[model samples]
Target chain A: MDVRSRNHVTVTGRVGGPVVMLAHGFGCDQNMWRLVVPALERDFTVVLFDHVGSGNSELSAWSPERYSSMDGYAEDVLELCRELALGPVTFVGHSVSAMMGVLAAAREPEAFAGLVLLAPSACFIDDPDTGYRGGFSAADIDELLESLDANYLGWSGAMAPVIMGNPERPELGEELTNSFCRTDPGIARVFARVTFLSDNRRDLSQVRVPTLVAQCSSDAIAPPEVGEFIHAQIPGSRLTTLNATGHCPQLAAPEETAAAIAAFARAAG
Target chain B: MTCGTGGEEGGRERDNGSGPGEEEALFSALLEDSTEDLYEHAPCGFLSTLLDGRIAKANATLLDWLGYRRSDLVGRRHFSDLLTVGGRLYYETHFGPLLRMQGEVSGVALELKAADGSRLPVMVTSKVKTGIDGQPLLIRTTVFEARDRRAYETELLRARREADQERDRLKLLNATLQTTLLPPALANVPGLDVSAYYHIASADEVGGDFYDLFPLATGTWGLFLGDVCGKGATAAAVTSLARYTLRAAAVYDPDPAAVLANLNTVLNHEYNGDDPRFCTVVFGLLTPDADRGGFHIVLASGGHPPALMMRADGTADFLPTPGGQLIGVLPDAHIATATVHLAPGDTLLLYTDGLTEARTAAGGEDRYGDDALLAFIRDLAPSTASDTIGAVRVLLGTFGTGVDDDTAVLAVHVPRAGSEERH
Candidate 1:
């Protein structure tokens, strides 16, 4: 009970129907959901806040030992939900945040109504028998980690193109690249390692909430098979394939992507 | 207790009785002559600590490396105070347990903080020195310099990084060279479905795989996909020559079997010496037939895997082009030629053995075989060439980095009139 209770959170929606909370991926803040927030705010209450050590969030609240794992981020999501009095909320997440959402939802199923996962990759290394094709080889991941340690900006520049391979939606890649570059280099390195190396396929099975996995057709980072893997593992989860390519389908095909999410939420509700 | 009180009083009495205090004289001589020299010049650093890891005694050698006076370390700081953050964790996790279990432990490596907070790599040995009756006492610790070993490891890592860079540069160059060996774009043959995919096994080394569809004499089209035997610049050289020679030869002959024959003859004449170049090629020629609205295709094989024929009615089987010898091996190679009629909606898939020969798993000998490919083709028999190719692309992506060699697939389908436009 001695834990800090003075923590504050902001919630906003004009034409509220239900609540949808979003958590951003590694090296990014809550501002990543800006493009999709406008569309969601039209129909639902949207709750947005940065995790500690990121964006508008208080940096003084960050403790390296506490924030060492995604559990800290999960606690932030749960705390934000509790503070906002948001019950049975739809949680939208990207990359590592998607797994964090899964862990959070698994921990408290009554708090989370559903999950919207975009470019969710459990593990980046390839496992032959399981037919999971997360693009990088073991040595490739090692080189990636080493480069992250040596020069974070250089690593982001190299990774951005690979993650966003779609030539048509160049802006999506630009946004991702910018978001990655904006992160503090030291924190970015640790966050990147945690994101890429984290194995969350096991956590998928524990998610009892209704889940929507909107996957890009030609994403080099999270291929369709990865989405299929998530769909197969998570019970009662629906998989919707997007014609868009690259990791961030929201930036590429926001209208169609948003429509799918809305439909899923409506159906679940 | 007996030695401390009784010996001290007896030593005083003996000093009074003896002429020059013999035992005390010898003890003083050893301390003055040998102890300081031993402490200063010993191979390892000698230090004592309190129960709280505080330094009590430290040798001059350890103090010199740390840029500290002996008085600075002893009685002032704990042993953990000297360690870096990582070293402190190691001390808590591994060092403390082993020291507690055994009376002594040795060869524990750690980074010790110097006087200016700079790091000094060291190997520490510690022992629990006890009283004569095994009662608890102070801890004794020894540390050795790890400067040379740390330097060697750093250099080795640097060298490894350089080697990796060299390999990556070579891979980029090989990718560029491989691009040149194949046509920039295969000439779009009208009324025929065309889709080709190339899978490179290792980017660091170039594999010889060349495929092209070129127009020949008499309104015919000749296409071939071949793999040269070896790798690197040598294989790349042969690949370039073979690709150009096949195109050039097809322009002269226009017959699929004869085009391959001429290519074989040219390769035999050019690279038929010691350390000669050899490759397996499957050549196909498409020509309009008067009897049927479809095209008559003659496929000549030179020691290549059979081309799969996925029919319009959803049945799939391999084209019979057997008994072909590997090109460039002999002066007169036996070429196997088979003629097939490509009606509307029929597709022909030509590929290298790399598709079938890829290992499915680590420590697994199960190659993704001909039967699996047949089933895969069977699933897509009634599809357009482009859809077939797109599906195959997805399948290849699924194979991921497991396909340890290059794979090239060139498919030509005589599509239904409207179907060709969509494809």
Candidate 2:
């Protein structure tokens, strides 16, 4: 059934079949699952939608204060599920959304059957006392922010290579640069602060679902240690490492990522 | 000739009468020559140091800047004696070595301690004097007030730090904001495998490639992927507006072409002035056709690159939906639509131009174009949606730094019957 979401949440797939939900990471949207959906549609129902401020979603639904925290996003997820009667869903999230899914599943564990997280980051800022690796220091973050404000396009252009760092066939930097240049500076500014500065390590313990954490071995943004931390914190969570160096493994190693998901889904079933 | 002779005679007579005047002129010349000497005593103190790093001569200008008297430095104390501890160390370690090697060192920044214990910033230049035998005799040093330079340097450093902090805040804000522009994840539709990948060429900021596949009506899905022109705040604003408008408009009417038309109208109207915004997009409606046991996809394009059709037989080609115009350019846009039957084992790929146009190398000469993409898929025939996207994802990874543009790829595949539902 069609339902209205404050965030323009649209429902798809079989209404009565088991619901499978997907979420993208920082700098991406729900479309990351396009390659995985067709194969999934064979047995279960699927539900896909952008976050409130995400792709093809309601821009007005974005409030800096509201989106600053993932609680509102979790609420939107729960509300969308309720509206579509897509209960007992298998929540699959990428990057920051992994923590977001944790937040949602924690609030309504009964609403979800399992969670598959791809390249998840619980905390992106370092905590020396806790031994957490966030890649850059607070000073570095300050420098990065200044760079962004000074010239958003320039900063994005410079960062493309770092974001798409792959040892072999390293040409995705241009793609990242173009992407950075295509976005509005204001939106990019806000999104940069939210993705890098916001830390949500404490939220991992709250997850109680059958969680599968897929991590990239050489991700500069969210290193391997982070995946281990998430797996350690989230009780009964399984961790698998993909031999990729990029921040977005699904885009870099889709076959391995899909295989992992397929294997995990089967194991869960 | 008579007038010249008379003038010469008159000049000679004048000259004869001007001996006293000549003497007075000489006296005046002497007085005028002493002006530099007078400068030494004219309120400001001055001083010069010898080549051996000792005070050889000093004037009032030098004494004033250092808050010292001539008796305290000239022929009495070494020039380094008036320096602060740090300044003396710096002079000995760095300044002395450089000056000795260079023969002359100008504007050597240093700090001096005053008699009253206050610090004085000064720029000093010193040159070595040599005798006729080419033997070094002494050093002559000049000092300039450096309070302003010090202040300026301090201000510059402060500004740099502030700018860095501001950039960091923006980066985080940009990251989060960028996240909001796309879905956290696209759900796996039952009976079909799906995979999508968005390649952002940058991370210090945001990009304008947007895509989504969300539930619309009963047993149907709505999905779209598009690229907005330009970057920074303006492009981001348009991106947000377009993303939301498309989703909202789709909810209003789930028709792929109509949804794009609605988006086109909103963007054109909202950003219709000078410095207007526009974008290339492809919108699709996926409904499970029980007759096909897959999906009936109505794909629409708005000046966007065509979606690739990777058939179950392993043939991949651009789904020809040409003649579409860019959204937000005109009041009314022609959105091209195409209907396709997604059979089991069929995979459809939608992507932004960033993928096709991305440079295959640092020089950006070799592009991963339509033919190359088709050839690539030809090798991976009979691929599932996830598999196809996974392969493309690897391709994106392989492109590495060459793919300078942000690419958004949305792939939908119809899984074959009797395939393992799980795992």
Candidate 3:
């Protein structure tokens, strides 16, 4: 299997420099890290890719069985490192992908140098028994799935012309185009279930590499307390709160986010 | 795009004592209502939320539909708070990022929760209102009621699922029907090794290819292979009629030519309408020849492909029954006959034209012609009936998607004097 083609892996930056692989989460694709790629590539090698069934990756490689759990994506991360033959590279995972990094690094600790968990959460649903305030409740995740179903027709590329029917307003044709974040509704629903319903709180301690947990100042999805929870769980992991506010610090504060990653990568090396 | 700024600049003028122009009077009355009325009582709902989704302002149209007072939402609840839990998550994961990246999103169907706990389906279109320095200021939204469209979409999804299940059932029915048109297993003739195969070209439609072997009289067997013109239900009907007629005709007289002529007479009489149906068939009568220790065979053709004979002496060729016109077209059809002795270690194979007419190359005008099949069989001589059919099956499998029509093959082989084997 050509894992690179399956995951839409792209290698850019200094050829022999230390590699930093960036992984995007559920809704979008490789374009999530486009803002910070330029700054990271100047000094360190940057590897970017879309998860299977997202963005420019080959959609045919997406199977419900293979990608049902976090292990499927974790397995892809390890295969990519082996195929690229980048020795002990740094991995930066956003949102749900942060758990993927933890799962991957735990299985093959030798394949990674360090991990940067940006706006990550060990779990997204609230746990009453454990008294953990990860975030939303289980019923909320079900609601999210229903919302995806309701908008299924709107997500299809064939429906774009129908929805953007206003010719007088050019913005309807330009900005609202379903290009980068448009996922197949069926795939998006599965990913939504996987993202919100999964609990990896116990797996946080399994990450053996030096890790940096970066969270935004204010994110509705992953709040400050959730970030604190992730930081306390990972042993000897450093936690930093960026000045930006949103679930995506890479897009919100690209410069500071890139600087933090570069300093951490150099220290880990 | 501030709310209600469209066409609200009409000047209020006092009516003169004398009759003024009728058009001017009507135009003045329409615009005199003021922008506040247009914003508050418009048919569609409108809102302006801050960048962080806190609602700064909302029109009366939306607040009225949600059964909320103006103070309940303005400067208090976020735009997402108006959505159901699922819609809120959809907003965070998909809709928010899309708006931030693309600057606008339109016609996103979502359900809003009212204070009364009723779900109001609505279509939302939001745009980012940029400041003078190209900095994001706030989001302007327009919401339209979409109850009818939502109901239609739900019905569409249900109909689509039923259509999918209906197609699957049709395929199963077609497969079962196809089975009934052919014998489950060939008749186990004594002192003969026999093998047969049918390759269906489609799963959704029953094919017309059929073959059977049955006992005709004492110490004799009657067998036939044929293909009806066209396909599906109409051709399947003709195939069923042809198969039964051949069996009945052979029982009256065991002569191969006489059996085929009788079939032609019956088909011509039954289907002599404006749209006549026809088929190509070959009938053969097999009888044990005690003097030669083999079976004596007399075969008749009705515009069907010639049968292939692999002799025991390591040579193979087609038994050409030329001038065999198609059956059921004329009052008296011309049937062609040929005789061959099926000695020990010799094999005779019957087949339809699907094998010779199959395409051999992808997107190329190359077909698996008769010459290719002949060359293949020439090298396959001195083999038993089972081995011959097995090799032919392997050859057909190699063609892959190139074989586009239904095909059937039946082989009869006589084992060596000491073997007494079944193929």
Query: Each candidate's iRMS in angstroms?
Result: 20.4, 20.2, 3.8
> Against the true structure, what is each candidate's TM-score?
0.54, 0.49, 0.76
Q: Chain B TM per candidate, please?
A: 0.76, 0.72, 0.77
Residue lDDT tens for model 2, B112-221: 77888987776667766768885557777777777897677557657876897999998888778888888998865777677788777877658888998888877888
Candidate 1 lDDT over A105-216, as tens digits, reads 9998888879998778777667787877876565655544443333322334433332233568788656645543445554654665666677788889999989998787
Q: Chain A TM-scores, all candidates?
A: 0.81, 0.79, 0.91
Give candidate 2's whole-model lDDT: 0.72
CAPRI category for model 3: acceptable
Q: List the pairs of residues colliding in candidate 3.
A: A143-B86
Question: What's the lDDT for all of these models?
Answer: 0.73, 0.72, 0.86
Give the candidate number with the greatest lDDT: 3
TM (chain A), candidate 3? 0.91
Task: Give a tens-digit lDDT track for model 3, residues A10-73.
Answer: 8999888998999998887887787799998888889999898887788888889978889898
Q: Which stretches of candidate 1 lie over 4 Å from their true place?
A: A1-269, B1-42, B46-60, B78-142, B288-291, B394-402
Candidate 1 docking band: incorrect
| Fnat scores for every prediction | 0.00, 0.00, 0.41
